[model samples]
Target: MALPSADQTGNMAEMEMQWAVKAMHHAETYMQLLKAVGGKNFKLTPIDDELYSDFKRNFPDLNIAVLNDDDFKTDMAKAKWREFINKYENRVTDFNFGSLLRIDCTGDYSEDNTMFVMRTQFYCIEIARNKEGLNDSHHS
Candidate 1:
């Protein structure tokens, strides 16, 4: 379905909410990949330090604060959110991680309608032995 027009400023807040839900789905896919590979027992190598440094330099305009909590409440938060979204969008386009599984949204102009989209990335990594069988244990 077509996305709502960008001119609908009155619905910006709702649009932002929809964006957040979509971002969370992206995060969820990461979490699920961790689980499928062996849950907490798996060890992901730290993202390459040099690559991360380059990431910072190459995407100076991208905001990394979305990964932090305090930035979410500040007045500049919207810029940060946009940066975060742009970063992953670029990641999908660059094929740096894995694949963009989906980006789905709903609603046209109705208050009751909502929109959602998701992008997925996959990576191949060595899975450490499930020493604790943590996957089987329940934690609160």
Candidate 2:
């Protein structure tokens, strides 16, 4: 996407780009964590391996095709890009923190084809840094 104009005050466009980058980075980290945990048990079909290899081989081309498109300057294009990025962020956050589950039923019934299931639980902690300056600047 085109970068936000230098003088724009409410820079939601740039913010969306920043958020997308952060979300993608978070996804990569999560994938790395999954790989580290699954190690030997991690199963990759030949098709999956080939697809991933191709993605790696042409990542720059794919990224340029997606992100450097000429229509990004238009308001409709920006809005669409924003919507896509928001959806992506919501999906990632759901996978990480939301109560969503998926079951894989890939094989024959006789073979007991319930292959995979996953549950994710996430927690957050916040600490107050200082209340000393709270509301004082407003009064002044």
Stretches of model 1 off by over 4 angstroms after superposition:
1-11, 38-50, 56-140
Candidate 1 residue 84 C-alpha distance from true site, Å: 12
What local distance difference test score does each model get?
0.36, 0.30
Cα lDDT tens digits for candidate 2, 63-86: 221123333335775564345334
1-140, model 1: which lDDT tens digit per residue? 87766675456788677766655565455446544654454333343333344445644543332223233335685465345446555434333332222111111112232222222112111111122232322211
lDDT of 1 at 111: 29
Worst 10 contiguous positions by lDDT, candidate 1: 120-129
lDDT of 2 at 103: 14
Give the poorly placed runs of model 2, Cα more than 4 Å off.
Answer: 1-11, 39-140
Top candidate, metric lDDT: 1
Looking at model 1, the pairs that clash are none
